[model samples]
Each structure stands twice: as structure tokens, then as C-alpha cells.
Target: MIRARAIIDRDALAHNLSRVRALAPHSRVYAAVKADGYGHGAVTVAGALAAADGFAVSSLDEALQLRWAGIDKPVAMLSQQLDATVCEQAGEYGLEPVVFHETQIEALERYVGPALKIWVKLDSGMHRLGFAPDRVDAIVTRLAALERIEINGWLTHLACADDPSRPETQAQLDVFAQVTAGRPGLRSIANSAGVLGWPAAHADVVRPGIMLYGSSPMSDRDASSYDLKPAMHLSAPLIARNPIAAGETIGYGATWRTPEAMDIGVIGIGYGDGYPRHAPSGTPVLIDGVRVPLVGRVSMDMITVDLRNAPNAKVGDRATLWGGGLDPDEVARHADTIAYELFCRLTPRVRFEVI
Candidate 1:
């Protein structure tokens, strides 16, 4: 048996996608499966999200992985592939590359043979990728001139769509609308946060990433508010139950001390299994559906949890790190990180089982 496992709920995955459809009924969805579907396994996520109009990935390798898995749906490469050889491979594999830089455009021009599907990225505000707003018109013109390359869509990323109070999202949307005004192609701008908060930015396609996995994109809201179910339930078994006296310190560095005599259940999971090492004392773990407080520094493969509330919890009892009753968002808050990082950082030592 695996010491730790990430239980992937396929029904929850599908439910989250359905929630996206309900929110953005008019927009086609490009499910973001990058970072191995945020470490939930890209191929598994793709199969669960079969209704998505397309899949967006970070590289050509990820796009081809879906193809190798027998997924024939359109795969959009969100990052630039400036290498001529990689661009040629993208074309052959029918992968759509997001063209942002002149170097990428040059590579595509040199290697594209019959026809290449492409999404032209515009730098509305994020300033991470995509062409500048002022240069998009000329860039579009140049890309259109290539007969073998088709500009399938114009897309931009939102930086602050998660915060509704921020005005930058609207400003970015305005610039995107202005730049792609008369363009005769699909327009996309919404990520998970954009799809939920900025309806005006939802054009022809809305690419959702975190929301499809059931975590809320907004800081103020939660997944339950959007009717999305948590997909990944991470759990580990209790391998040791030890009696500790008051003032006894547990784990490395003696960071946590027992307030009273209590049973410390050592769970067979820790940073090595992708549990956050930064998770502080008092972070909650679920034992038999009851919340228990973590009492010590997380070790490489074990964490000591105070099992005062659950006296029956013993060796072999499963302790939930997140998901099910305990939300990953809540755990993420304790770790001073986002749910995306928590999901994506799981090591290969952790087993993933789809249910």
C-alpha cells in the first residue's frame, strides 16, 4: 500500500467543468492542463473534461502528451516556441502555439508548411507574455500575410481578475477590445477569475485553470460558492500513535510543544509527499471526518498531529491532508501559499488514484 496518495475525484472534476459551463454559457472553454493539470495528471484531467472545447498547455511536450493518450481535441500551446525545430514539430502534431514575440513569428514563418493554427497573444497588462498593445495591429498584419499560418484567435491574460476591487482588469479588457476590434478571429481573455468576475472579458473562448479543479479563483470567495467540488483528496495513514507528556516537544527543531498530555498521531506523509513544509503548527488535518491540529514541524515523511479530539484514531486510520471536508484553500491559507502551488508541487513519491 502507498504511504500517501492523492485521490482524484473524477466526478468532482467533471462537476467543476459543468460549473464553468454554467458560468460562461456563451463562451467556449479551453481547459488549462498545464503543470500536469496542476499535478492532478493532465491525461486524467483531459479525459474527465471531455466536454471542453480545447486544452491549453505550457509547452509542445504537454500538448503532444494528450495526443499520445488518444485525446484528439485541439491543444493550444500558451507559451512561445522560438526554436524552428520545435515549431515544426508543433505544426506536425497539430498543436496551436500562442505567438507573442517577433522571434517566434520568425521561427513559425520559416518552418510552417501547409497551415498552422495559432493564437496571437496581446500584452494587455500582465506584461509577462504577448505582444504590446501598440504593436498588435502591425503584428497581426504580418502574421496574416503568411498564407500557411492561420490566426485562429486573439488572447490575453488577466493579472488581477481574482480581485474584483482592482480596476486594472477592466483597463486590460478595454485595451484588448481596442486592439482586436476589427479582427476576424476568435477572441479570448478570461481565465478562471475572469470567467467568474469579469463577464465582459469573456469573448469567443474562456480558458479556465484553477476553477476546473474546484478551488475558487477569487480571494474573497470559495469553491462551494461557485458550486464546484474539490477534485483532489490527499490522505495518508497514521503509522504511529504515541503518548506525550505536557511540555514535550515534537518533531524537528522542537517547534511545537504539547499543552497537555495527549496522543500524537504520526501520519505517514510530509514535505516529501508534497505536503507544504511551511505549514505551521495548528494547521488542521481531518481524521475520521473530525478536524485535528498539527502539533509539530513537518518531517521529510511524517507529521505529528494532536489527536485529542479523536481518541479512537489509531495506527492505520486515514488522515486527510486536504480535500473532502477539509478544503485545500483553507490549508493553503495556513501555508501562506495558493492552492495551485500546493497541487502542482506534489512529488512523484505520492501515488495518484482516480476514483
Candidate 2:
């Protein structure tokens, strides 16, 4: 048996995708499977998310993972550096590369490969990757000159759609609309946040990232608010249960002290397995559905949790780290991070199981 593992729930994975559809009913869904399905195991979830119109990945290699796994749906490469060689491979594999910079467009214009499918990205205020909105005219005109290139869609990323009240999202959407007016191919802007918050940003396609993996794209709300199920259940076995006296310090730095004489369960998980080392005392865990507060400093391979909530928890009971009953977003908040980091940073030492 695996000491610690992330159980990928296929039904929940599909349910999350359905949630995206529910939110963006008219748009084609490009389920973001980047960062190895946000660390839920890409290929496995890709196979399960087959209902998605397509899959979005961060790099060319990630796109290949889906293709190699026999996923024939359109795979969009969101951040792969486009070059002559990269363009050729993209053409061969039918991958759509998001060409944001002028140099990338130059690479596509110069490529004599069979044909390439690509998405033209507009900066739209994120100012991260896409071409500036002012350049959209020249971008559209220049791209019109390339016979070998096909615009799979005109897409942009939202910087603050998570906060629906943020004016920047509306301004960005306005800029996107003004720039791409009367243009041809599909238009996409809604990430998971936009999909949930700004229905107007859902153009011809909506590429949802975190929500598909069962994490909230918004801070104030949770996945359950949208009826999204947790797709990844992370847990580990309780390796030891010991009695501790009041004032007994636990783990490194003696950061946590027992408030009273009680039993503490040592779970087989830690930062080494992607359970946040920064998770302070009072972070919650679950044993047999009983909520247990995490105590002490997390080590590379172990963490101690106060078992007051689960007096029946034993040495072999599996402790739920952030799924099933407990929300990953809640755990992420206690760790002073977001669920995305928790999902993406999980080390390979932790076993992954697909259900």
C-alpha cells in the first residue's frame, strides 16, 4: 500500500467539467490540463475529461503527453516558445500554439511546414504574454498574410476575474472586444475565474483551468458553491499514534506544543509529498471523516495531527489531507498559499492513483 497518495476521482473530474459547461453553456470548453493536470496526473485526467471539447496545456511537451496517450482532441499549447522546429512538431501533431509575441508570429509566418493551427493572444491588460491590444490591428493584418497559419481562435487571459468586482476584468474584456471586433476565428477569454464570474467573457470558447480540477478560481467562494466536486483526494496513512503530555513540543523547531494530554497521530505525509511545510498548527486533516487539527511543524516525510476529534483514529487509519470532506482551498488558505501551488508542487515520491 502506498504511504501517501492522491486519488484522482474520475466521476468528480467529469462533474467539474460539467460545472464549467453549466457556467459557460454556449462556449466550447478547453479544459486546462496544464501542470500535469494541475498535478492531478495529466494523461489520466485527460482520458477521463474526454468529454471536453479540447485540452489546454502549458507547453509542447505536455501537449505531446496527451497526443501520445491517444487523445485526438485539439490540444492548445499555451506557453511553448514557437520556433521553426517547434512549429514543425506542432503541425505534425496538430497542436495549437498560442503565438503572443511578434517573434513567435514571425516564426509562424516564416514556417513552410504543412500547416499550423494557432491562437492569437491579446494582452488585454494582464500585460503578461499576449500582444498589446493596440497591436491587434497589425496582428490581424499580418496574420492574414500567412497561408500556412490558421487562427484556431483569438484568446486573452484575465488577470483578476477571480474578483468579479475588479474593474480591470471589465476593462480587459472591453479592450478584447474592441480589438477583435469583426474578426474571424473563435474568441476566447474566460479562464476558470471568468467562466464563473463574467459570463460576457465567454466568447466562442472558454478555457477553464483550476475549476476543472475541483479547486475554486475565486477566493471568497468554494468549489461546492458552484456544485463542483473535488477530483483529487490527497491522503496518507496514520503511521503512528502516541500519547503526549501537556507542554510536549512536536516536530522540528518545537513549533507546536500540546495544549493538554492527548493522543497525536503521525501521518505519512509532509512537504516532501507536497503537503505544505508552511502549514502551521491548527490546519485541519480528517481521519475516518472526523476533522483533526494538524499540530506541530511539518517535516520532509511526516506530520503530527492532534487526534482529539477522532478518538477512534488508529495507526492504520487513512488521514484525508485535502479532499473528500475537507476542501483543498481551505487547506491552502491555512498554508498561506493557493490550491494551484499545492496541486502543482506535489513531489513524485507521493503515489498517484486514478479511479
Candidate 3:
């Protein structure tokens, strides 16, 4: 029997995509499915997001994964420094990749296969990827000179679109607009945060990542506020339950003790399953759909939860880590991390079943 599993709800995924369409009606949805669809399984969600205009990935192999899975939709490899091999694979597979360097242009020049489409990535203020605003024209010119390639458009990443209170997103948007002025092809600037919080950043292409999987892109809001549904339900079985006396400490490091005599359950999941190791005591876990406080420290393969709130919960009842009734953002807040990391960090040990 599977002790713990992450249930991927494709219906919820499709519902979220509909939300993206509503938010950016004029833009194409380049749904981000990189990091194996944020650990929800890339190929799995691709089928669910068939309505999306295309997919946005992080690497050539990520694109190939979809292609091999029979997903022929346009897949754009997001802004990155490309190598000769990656460029060749991209052309061969009909992928639209972002290019910023002269070396990448040269590699495309050497490619003699089918015609390729490419996007020039400009550093709009993220400073992580993309070419400088001053160098975009030169790079675009060089890329445009390639006989067998199509300059799909310009691309830029927003630094602080997650919170509209920050001015960086607008500054980045301004830089992108000026750099790509009178430029050929379309412009893509919105990620999930941009899709939800910055309508001005919604250019010709909008790539929604975490929000497509049902997590809120902004800190000030929850997913429900955006009409998003929970797409992944993580749950583990309660392995053991024991009555503890008041003042009795629990688990490794003796980090928590019983405030009063109450039953505690041993849940069959922990860091080994990609549950955050640093998740402190009092993090909420849903026991048989009832909220229970996580007690002590998370172990390699187990966790302890106070059953006072779930007095009738049985040893074999499923305990939810997040999703469904519990918001992943809420769980993330308790763990002091974002929902993205929690989704991407799941190990292969956990069973992933599509629903």
C-alpha cells in the first residue's frame, strides 16, 4: 500500500488555465511546465493544459519530454544562454528558444537543418538572465541575420511582479518596452505573478507558472482570490497513534512537548519524501480533513502531529500535507517557504497519481 502520495488533479489544472485565459485574454498562454511541471510531472499536465497556446520550459530536454510524449504544441525554452547542442535540438524539434549571446547566434548560424524560431532575452532588471538593454539591438540584429532562423520576438523577466507595491516591475516593463520598440515579433514579459498582478506586463505572450498549478503568485493574496483551485493533494497515512501525558516531550531534539494529555499520530512522510525538514512545530496537517498541529520535528520518513483536534482520526486515516482543503500557501507560510519549492522538492519516493 502506498503510505503517502501526491494526487495531481488535472481538472483543477485545466480550471486554472481557464483563469489564465480570463486574466490575459489578449495574450497567448505559454504555460510554464519546467522542473517537471514544478514536480507535478510535465508530460502529465501537458495533456491537461491542451487549451494553452503552448508550453514554456527551462531546458531543451524539457521541451523534448513533451515532444516525445506527443505534445506537438509550441514549446519555448525560456531565457537562457544556449549551447550548440541545445540550439541544434531546438531547431530539430521546432522549439522557440531565447538567445542573448553572440556565441548562441553563431551556433544557430552553423545549424543547417529546418528553419528555427528564437526570442532575444533582454535584461529588464532581473540581472539573472537576458542581454543588457543596450546590447539587445545588436544581438537581435545578429540573430536576424541568420538565414534559417526566425526572431520570434523579445523576452524579459520581471524582478518584482509578485508584489505590485514594488516599483521594480514597472521599471523593468519600461525598459523592455523601450528596448523592443519597433522590434519585429511578439514580446513576452509576464510570468504567473505578471499574469495576476501586472496587467501592463502582459505582452503578446504570458507564461503562467505556479499560478497554473493553483498557487497564488502574490504574497498579499491567496489562490482563491484569483479563482484558482488546488491542483495537488499531498497526503500520508497515520502510522501510529499514542496517548501522551502532559509535559512529555516529542520527537528528535525534544523540540515539542504535550501541553496536555492528548493523542499524537505518526505520519508516514518527512524530508525523505520532500516534506520540508525545517518545517517547525505547529505547522498544520489535515487529518481526515481536520486541521491538526504538527508536533516535534519532521523526520526522514515520518512526522508527529497532535491529534487533539482530530480525536476520532484513526491510525490509517490519511493526513494531508497540503492542497484540497488546505492551501499550499498557508502550509508554505508555516514552513517559511513558498509553494513552488514545496512542489519542486518532492523526491521520487513519493507516489504521484493523476486524478
Candidate 4:
């Protein structure tokens, strides 16, 4: 069997969902299972989080996949609905489409079918999607005239909820509140960061993504602070161990050199398996349950780790890349990235086992 594998912990997923509920007891959860549950496998995650009020995905196909997997919960497509055909399909599948532009509303207007539940997205502050807040009233009026669709609610993405200190989060929330106040449908503005940091944004519905996978949404705090357990445990085997003399260089570009005679262990995973290539030397990996420093440039299929901290480490010893005791957020920090990218960018070469 391939030693490189990711273990998906269903219990941790459920626990994280419970944490979201604990934070916003009055709000409904639309769990984001997009990007294949951030590479944990969407169907598997949906099964574990079946109790979520709804599942949110990036496309109609993803929502359909969950439905085919026996997930009966409401599935909302967070991305825009591009055409009338997609709008019709969404109605057929009972999937909710997020209308972010005038084109989407027109598409829905043209569709002829049973009423479709739709969430109108407002460009609160992100400016990446959704209509401008000023245009929301006009959009809602047009939407209200559409007889074939039901306005489920209004939703917005937070630009900086991860850092509560940033004034933009509250600014966005204020705009969202002002724009949707007295609206007939539910109003949702919180993502995982909002659920953790900005309680004021926890409106009628909360969409929690990265935090549900046990990663900290905050830049200053760790996941443990929120009692979030990592749902994916990535590990590989040490395929080779070599003794290197002092001043000897290792890996491509000779990015690292030993200051003294030391044992170097080669792990059977790398960027090819979605490990970050930019992860610098001194990044942590776990061998025999002991933390060790990565010693050389991360290669296509391997990474070299200094075994000085774990001399008993031998070939075939298990090395945890992240998860378990080591968090993906820590690894991502060393790579100058976020845990969301680390989890979502995992390559298909890494086998996954649901636990």
C-alpha cells in the first residue's frame, strides 16, 4: 500500500459542526462542502455532516453529487447561475442558486418551472461577487416580480472577518444589515471567521467552511482555541535514512546544510502530493510522534527531514506531514499560505481513508 495517505476523521467533522452550532445557536448552518469538502471528499463530508441545515457548493454539479450521494438536505450553489438552462436544472434538482448579477436574475426570470429557491448575493465589501449594495433594492424588486422563483434569502461574503481587528468586517456587516433590513427572507453574512470572531454578523444563516474542517480561521489564534479538531491527518513513511557529515548539503538547490554529523530521513511525499513546494527548511514534520525539522528543499515526491530529534526513526517509520498533533495551519504558515489552500490543493496522488 502507498504510505502517503490522508485520514479523514468523520467524528472531528461532526464535532466542528457542533462548534458552529454552539457559536450561533439561533442561526441555520449552510456548511460549505465545495472543492470536494476542501479535498476531504464531498460525499464523505456530507455523510458526516448530514445534520447541517444545508450544504453549499461552488457549482450545480457539486450539489447534484451530494443529492446522488443520498444527501437530502438543501444544497445551495454559492457561485452564480450563468444561464437559463442552469437555472432550470437547479429547479429540477431542488438546488438553490446564488444570483449575483443582473444576468442571473434575467436567467431565472426566463426559466419556466416550479419555483426555485434562490439566494441573492450582495457585494458587501469583497467586490468579488454579488450586486452592489445600492443595487440590491432594484434587484430584489425585480426578483419579487419573478413568479417562478422564491427568494430564500440574501447572502454576502466577508472580506476580513478572519481578523476581527479589521474594521472592514463590521463595515461590511453594517452595510449588509442596512441593505437587508426588513427584508422578507433570511439574511446570511457569516462565514467561518464570522462564526468565530464577529458575532454581530451571525444573522439568520451562517456558512462555515474551513473551520468545519478543523482549521483556524483567525490569523492570530490556533484551532485549539476554538476547540476545533482537524478532520484530515496526512502521513507518509520514511523510505530512506542516511548519515550526512557536517557541512554536507542536501536536496535540490542545496537549500539546507548540516552544521554537524546528522541522520537525514527521506519522507515519501512532496509537492506532487500537494505538499507546498515553497515550504522552507526548518518546517516541522512528525516522526515517531516526535517533531523534527525539514532539512532540505521539498522535492517532487520526497522531503528530507533531520532525524536528530528522533534517532530511533528508521525506514518505514510513519511521518505525519500535518494533522494529528501537528496542525495544517502551522505548515501553511511556514509556506506563506492559508490552511484552506493547503487542504483544497491536495493532489489526487494522495490516497484518502475515511475514519
Candidate 5:
């Protein structure tokens, strides 16, 4: 068997969801399982977070997958672009469609079925796929007579809640409140960032995504802030250790030349396994709780890390590429990206072990 594997901790997932619950005590947490639980495996993460108020998926297909896997929680697709056949399937599978645009509303109205649960999306500020805040009343009035369509409530996405001090957060909340004022239905506006940093944004339903996977959506927060544990530990066993002389190039393009003689261990994971190819040297990795620096260019199937600080590191020594001691956020920062990309980019080449 290959030594490289992804370890998924269900306990960690539960812990993180609990933190979201605490943060938005009065709101229902819609666990975002989109992008396959942001790469932790959707069905697995959804099942693990079954205690959540509900689940959120990206498409009707994802919702169907969850249903096929026997997850019966209410799943709201963040985007709804389904055809008549797909919309019927959604009704049959008990998936909620997020109606954002007038066109989607028209489609759903045309496909009118008995089991369709609708969640209207209001464009408070993101300016993405959602009804304009000012048009909420007219849209609601139009849909109120559609007996087949179950208008459950409202949902909005936050743009800058990740920046805790941004005034835009309050502006969005005010707009959302104005649109949803005294509505006798469910109201939702919080994402992971909104749940953690913007208290006013937390309405009847809070959608927590990145945080449920043990990542802080807000740059101002970290894993420790909310008592959350990382659900994924991407690791590989050291394949070999080679000593290089000073002034010799280490990897492709010779991007990093050794300043002195050093012993480095090769790990059996690379871009093929979803590690970033552009990850520069000095990216922090963890081996037995000790920090190691990645050296040289990452290849399709291998990477070399300086083990001088971890002299005892040897072949078969565990290399935590991310998670545990090393935060995936830091790696994302080094790659000029976010944890969402880092997680979803992990290919199926690596084995996944759920704990």
C-alpha cells in the first residue's frame, strides 16, 4: 500500500460544527458540504456533521449524491441551474433549490412539483446570483401564490465579513434586515466568517463552510480561537533521504541551491496528489511535531524537504504536509491562495482514511 494518505477526523468535524453552533446560538447552521465538503469528502463530512441544523451543497447533483449516500438532512444547493428533469429529481430527492435570479424562479415555477422547497436568495451586497434587496417584496408577492413552491425563507452571502472591522458587514446586515423584516419565514445570511465575526449577520439560519472543515474564514481568526480541530491531516511517509553538497541545485529549475551540506528527505506526494506546484521553498511542514522547510521545486509525484532540524527524521517518517501542527492556511498563504482551493485541489490519487 502507498504510504501517502489523507486522514479525516470526524471528531474534529463535530468539534468545529459545535463551535459554529456556539457562535450562532439562535441560528440554524447549514453545514456547507459543497466541493465535497471542501475536499474532506461530502458524504463523509455530512454524515459526521449530522447533528448540524442542515447541510448545504453546491448543485443538485451534490444533493443527490448525499441522498444516495442516505443523508436525509435538508440540503440547500447554493446554486440552482437545473433543467426541468433535474428540478423534478430535486423535488423527488427532497433537495431545496436556492432561487437567486428571476429566471431560476421562472424555471421553478414552470416545473412546479409537489415536493419543491424553495429558499429565496437576496442580493444584499455580494451582487452575485440573487434577487435585488429592493425587489424582495415583489418577488415574494409573485411566488406567494405558487402552491407547489414552498417558500421557506431568505439567504444572503457576505462579501467582507472576513474583515472583522469592515463597515460593509453592518451595511449588509442592515440591508438584509430591511428586506427580511418581520417575515414569518426562516432568514439566513451568515457564512463561516459571518458566524464567527459578524454577530448581527447571524439570522435564523447560518451557513458555516470553511469553519466546519477546521479553517478560519476570517484572516483575524485561527483554529485555536474557536476551539476547533482540523478535520484533515494530509501526510506522506518519507521515501528517502539524500545528503547534498553545498552550492548544488536541489530540484527542477534549480530554484533552491543548498547553502551548505544538508540531509533532505523525499516525500511521495506532489501536485498529482494535490500539493501545490507553486509552493515555494521555506514552506513549513511538520514531521513528528518538528517544523521542516520544503526545498526545491515540487514535482508531479514527489517533493524534498530539509530535515536538518529534524535529524532523526528517516525513511518512513511521517510528513504532515498540512493539518495538525502545520496550518493549511499558512500553506495557502505561501501559495497565494486560500484554504478552499488547497482542500478542493487535492485529487483522488491519495487514499482517504476516515476516523
Candidate 6:
């Protein structure tokens, strides 16, 4: 079978997590491994980071997958499919749930058995989810009544940490601090961007997601500046090489036309394997560690790359669509998206091999 492969470097993951700890020395690191460790494989990444302080995931199903793999760390589900049975399952696996609204708290009270660890999510700014920060008192009071509930922490999310100059981040931090001011338990407000940019928001815990996987959290910052190494390098072998004449066009829409006779190499990876389809011409790819340019519209199972610089490019040569010598961030930028989407979109059809 023709294989598109991802090389995961466990050492790079360790370095990335270590960088997180260095950035926020006073705060505990919670590695957000949701979306199957952002498409790097949850169980694999979790096991690799077994020394990490804790793991944060999106749902009970994710938490259960970690539990099945023998990861015994403290796990907090950032959000879950709210239901009675799953609430019980969260407790069963020692997974903490984010209680954002009154209904979830009430459900936890009714369905929870022994001890329930809940991270109360406050909507300081990211209106996507969480209870109103001003209503902490009411939410606290409701949770305090449950005999099995242990209010482990106060949590909030940053709306603009990715864009450092946006004053909304500081405003959100101020709001978060105001509400969590006197709370005895842990207070967490740092996502990857928050961990890198907003130091004041790093309270008792810092949840670093993309950064833990060695990708830049902000549009402007380089991941290397943080000493974060990319954990995954996606590559495939060249399948075909052809020389197109000056008048010929390439790919589905014939989006690209050759201006001169040029050698083009076909890489055995495509949108089906999570390579972004919208990648315009001139998007960077790597042939034997030398940069090459993408030449056409990406297809469901293949991508054509310009091999002018790599005159030695051949049918069996390795092509790095992203990862290895070429960074995923560069490709993401050309595609006008974030590294998060690029990483998470990598599908199961691509084989994974840990290095």
C-alpha cells in the first residue's frame, strides 16, 4: 500500500512541555490532548507525557480512551456531552468536568457518586461557553450544596491572547482575576496563547494545547523562539515526475499554468490525508530538506510540487508536505489558517510512526 506517514518525535514533545513549564514556572501544566492530541494520537501523546502534571481533553470519550491506555494522571474534560450516564463515567475514570451552567451542576449533583471534581468555567470573555464571571457566587453556592462535589478550580478562557496587542486579553484577565480573587482552589486561565503571551493570566494552572504539540499559538510568534520543537513531521515518497511544457496547466481546475518547461513531482498525499485543499500555488513543500513550491490545486489523494530547485527530485524521493524540514506553520500560513486546524485535520489514513 502507498503510505503517507507522520513521524512523531517523543523527545520533541518533552521539549515542548518543558518549555511550557519554564514559561509559567509557578503554574502547573495541563497538557490539552483533545481531538486525539490534536490529531497526533491521544493515547500515544498522553503516554509520552506521562510525567506531565495533568491532561485536559474535550469529552468523556477522550478521557476514557486515555484511561484505557493506562494514563493515571489527573484528567479534566474541558467540555463533555452532558448526560447522566457520562457524568457518572467521568467520576468513574476520575475525570474532572467543566461545569459551565446551572443545569450541569444540578445534573452532577443528581448523578454523581462519591467524589466529583469540577472545574467551574467562568465566561470572562470567550462567549463560546462558561458561566458569567459575575455570577461566581451563585454558581459556587449551588455547587457547594452537593455533598459529592469538590470544587477543584476556577477556569476562564482568553479571547485575544493570540493577537498580543488586542486589549481584550488584559480585560479578560482582569475580569477573571476579579471573580477568582478569593477562591481557595486552583485558578486556570491560560490556553496556548495565554501561556505564551499573558503572564498575569497564569494563575494556579496553565493549560497549553498547541504549544505542547510544538506549534505556535499566536500568528506572530515563532515556535522555535519558545524552544518548542514540532512533535510530528508528515512526509511521503514521490510517486511520479513529469516535465510540463510552457503552455500546459495542472490539477483539477487547471489553476496553475506552466510559464516554462519545469519538472514536477507528485507526492502521495492529499486533502484526503488532511493536507489543506485550499493551499494555493507556491505553498512550500520540502524535497530532501530543500524547499520546493506546490504547483497545483491539491487533490483528494495527491499534490503536485515544482521541483526546479530540486533538480534531483525523483519518483522515490521523500517529499515533506509539512513537518520534518518544512514547518506545518508555513503551509498553514499559505493556506490562510492556523496550525491547530492543520494538525487536527490530519486523518487516520496517514500512518503514524513514532521516532
Q: Rate the local accuracy (lDDT) of all candidates.
A: 0.90, 0.90, 0.90, 0.91, 0.87, 0.87
Cα lDDT for residue 127, candidate 6: 96
Residue-pair clashes per prediction, in order, are 0, 0, 0, 0, 0, 0
Candidate that beats the other on lDDT, 3 or 5, i.e. the better one? 3
Clashing pairs for predicted structure model 2, backbone only: none
Higher-lDDT candidate of 1 and 4: 4
- lDDT per residue for candidate 6 within 229-276, as digits (tens), equals 989998888999998888899999898998899888899999999999
Model 5 over residues 1-355: C-alpha lDDT tens digits?
A: 4766889999999999889888888888889999888999999999899898789998988888899999888999889686788788888888888988787777777886666888988888889778897788889887887778888988889999999888888898888888888886799998989888888888789999998988887877786777778899999989999998988988899888888998878999999999999999998888856999999999999999988899888887789988877888888998888888989999989899999
- Which candidate has the highest lDDT of all? 4
* Model 5 stretches astray by more than 4 angstroms: none
TM-score per candidate: 0.98, 0.98, 0.98, 0.98, 0.97, 0.97
**What TM-score should be assigned to candidate 4?**
0.98
lDDT of 4 by residue, 1-355 (tens): 4768999999999999999999999999999999999999999999999889999999988988998888888999998556977877787888899889888877877889888999989998899999997797798889889888799999999999988789998889888888888888998899999999988989899999999999998978999999999999999999999999999999999879899999999999999999999999989999987999998899999999999999898898889998989989999999999898999888989999999
Query: Which is better, 1 or 6, measured by lDDT?
Result: 1
CA RMSD for every model?
A: 1.0, 1.1, 1.1, 0.9, 1.3, 1.2
Mind giving the per-residue lDDT tens digits that candidate 1 earns over 89-187? 777778889988888988876875557888999999999998998887688778878888899999999999999999999999999999888888999
lDDT of 6 at 283: 96
Error of 6 at 169 (Å): 0.8
Better candidate number, 4 or 6, judged by lDDT: 4
- Candidate 1 vs. truth: CA RMSD? 1.0
